[model samples]
Target: MQIHAHYNGAKPDPYLINHHLEDNRLSPESALKIIATSEPGGEAVGLPEFVFLNPQADPAPDKPLQYMIKELFVKETFRSAGTGRALMNWVIAHAQAAGCARMDWHVKPTNEAGIRFCRSFGADAVAGRVSFRLMLR
Candidate 1:
């Protein structure tokens, strides 16, 4: 919820969150949710969510899977404390172990900090492409 609020600048609907969680539970391997904490059983300071994608035609023939990061959030207090980097490193390693050909994600054009963080990992944005969405509800 905190991560969602941070990005959206508003609280998310609890009903929607619960519904999303239940759906993920039904197909756990489709998504991965990771929380970072200072100690075992401690409060969360960061969260990263990624999904495994299997397309009809694999983008990389040698690797059958791909990873798409849905969200990556580190609390403001923990932003410069290596929390985000740690989360990203873990995700990258996990994707590699799962035979993912590539990993990609998006950052809002105005999110300079997010852009810098992604660039630090050598991530580049796809050129000549635009994102579009349709809200069914």
Candidate 2:
């Protein structure tokens, strides 16, 4: 139920959230995109979802901006309910409106379902990049 708790606003660890919020508030090129889904009668159907976006400008000003999807998630129970597709479509619309050339996000190689889902949107894995992370305490 950690996903449920997280989307319900129980910020067990506030450091990252605070940092991202601050960054969003301070930068025009950066933002936090949060989408909350609920029932028609105003009931919570599942946890809210969110994605972090950063619009990077191309070297050539004539080109459109590039939007990076820093993170994306939907509750496991809510998968295949059209929520993920709807959310991704919304992101795509927003990116287009913002004049973004493309919207990009990475997926773990082990997540075959994720890869398939992304591919459904015409997203292909970039051939030359490796994802790396370094956690600092």
Candidate 3:
């Protein structure tokens, strides 16, 4: 079994990722387009987002640093194969190597799997929720 991390834009599995995330308009292109169109910085989006996946390679960093996990999803078929754990492991190693004192994750409370998996990574909820009302049309 082999594991790799890569940008969706450059991978052969873009098709797979697109297919898996398509139902809810979760394609990487659309996501990037959204980012590109953001007003210089950006506003908050409540939707679950994945910034990267199993990257096979790493960027050349002169110092210790962990790559940020922009978005995450558990592929239905790979749930039992430790894919999620592998991803977290990559994060841990990256952070440790990057000189970060600790790593963090933000998962919705309703995401039981995400919650459980994060706990498995020794992630404790240091803070609770912050809520507000939106006057959407």
Identify the superior model by lDDT, candidate 2 or candidate 3: 2
Candidate 1 lDDT at 115 equals 92
User: Per lDDT, what order, best first?
Assistant: 1, 2, 3
Give per-residue CA lDDT, model 1, range 55-76, as digits (tens): 6655777898989888888888
lDDT of each: 0.82, 0.66, 0.48
Q: Higher-lDDT candidate among 1 and 2?
A: 1
Off-target runs (Cα >4 Å) in candidate 2 are 4-30, 41-60
The local lDDT score (0 to 100) that residue 54 gets in candidate 1 is 86
Q: What is the C-alpha local distance difference test score of candidate 3?
A: 0.48
What TM-score goes with each of the models?
A: 0.81, 0.67, 0.46
Off by over 4 Å in 3: 1-68, 128-137
Clashes of 2: 0
lDDT comparison, 1 vs 3, better candidate: 1
Model 2: how far residue 3 lies from native, Å: 3.6
